[model samples]
Target: MNVQRGSTTFLKVIIFLIGFAVLAVCIVLLPEAARRDAIERPGDYSLYPLLVCAYGICITFSVALYRVFKLLTYIEKKNAFSELSLQSLEVIKKCTFTVIFFIFLAIVYLRVHAQYTGDDAAGPISLGLMGILATSIIAAIVDVLQKPIKNVLNS
Candidate 1:
């Protein structure tokens, strides 16, 4: 029990750090990058809308992270197969899907904008594609885990 408690605490700390790092990037790095892009390419207001969408995705991701933290708490309490844990996994899966959808939109926007401006869209598009892939995998894993958890809860 002590070992499980320690491991859960460690996992919780890791998740907290991840959340902090993501928040820092969204708060500090993204705006700076957007400002630089705006200055470098004057009169191109496309980035602002992209930034807004990205921020919205980040907010959803933050909520998902909070749900994950709650799920961890449940696990620490030896309630990993509880309905609340299942719910948290469901919410996390949905959030990952949302993130994936937003990344797809970002990819489309980047492709269109690149065609119009002749800018190299490869970097951003690749990044968005990777995000989609990663989130999709996360969602799939959560879904797979959910079934087993549901079964356990029922039994």
Candidate 2:
């Protein structure tokens, strides 16, 4: 039990750091990216809205991470099979889908912009594709976990 507790604590700390890192990146890098894009391609404000969307998605990601941390805390307290844990998982899965939706929007925006400007958008488009793939997987895993959690609750 002690070892399990320690591991969960470690995982919680890591999740906290990840949330922090996401905030830090949005704070420090996103504005710079927006500015750089504006300067490099004058009159092209398309990327600005995409950056905003990315920040919104980051907010969803943070919420999901917070839910994961809360779930971990419940697990540490041996309440993993409780209704609260199931709720957290449900929220996390919703957040994942939200992020995936935003990524899809970003991809569509980038594709249209690239077609208009005749620029190479493959790199950013590929990144968005990867995000969609990853979040879809996360959602699937969360759904799978939910089934077992439901069984546990019923038992």
Candidate 3:
């Protein structure tokens, strides 16, 4: 039990680091890159919508990450089978689906913009596809995790 608690503590630290890394990317890297792109292509009005979608995806991802952290805390408290943990799992699943929706919108926006502008949308489209794939996997995992919790709660 001591070892398990120690492992959860370590996992929490890792999760915090992951969240911090994402925050830095959202705050520092994304805006800078977007500004540079806008300066280089001043007429690309489609950029704003794609950026909005990207931010939406990031926000949903942050919510899911926080929920995962909460779920971990529940586990550490030996309340992983409780309603709170189940709620956290459901929130994570919902967040993942929200991200997927944003990714899809971004992909469609990029594709349509590229069609009008004759720009190659391959890179962003590929990234969006991968994002969708990842979110789908996360949702599946959450579904599987929820089943056991639901079973425990119902019993």
Compose the digit string of candidate 3's lDDT tens values, residues 99-123. Answer: 9999999889889888988999999
| Alpha carbon lDDT at 148, candidate 1 | 91
> What TM-scores do the predictions have?
0.92, 0.93, 0.93
lDDT of 3: 0.89
Q: Is candidate 1 or candidate 2 better by TM-score?
A: 2
> Number of backbone collisions per candidate, in order?
0, 0, 0
RMSD, model 3, all Cα superposed?
A: 1.5
Q: Which 10 successive residues of model 2 have the least lDDT summed?
A: 44-53
lDDT of 2 at 139: 98
| Candidate 3: residue 92 lDDT (0-100) | 92
Go through the candidates in order and give each one's C-alpha lDDT.
0.90, 0.92, 0.89
Q: Which stretches of candidate 1 lie over 4 Å from their true place?
A: none
RMSD (CA, Å), each prediction: 1.6, 1.4, 1.5
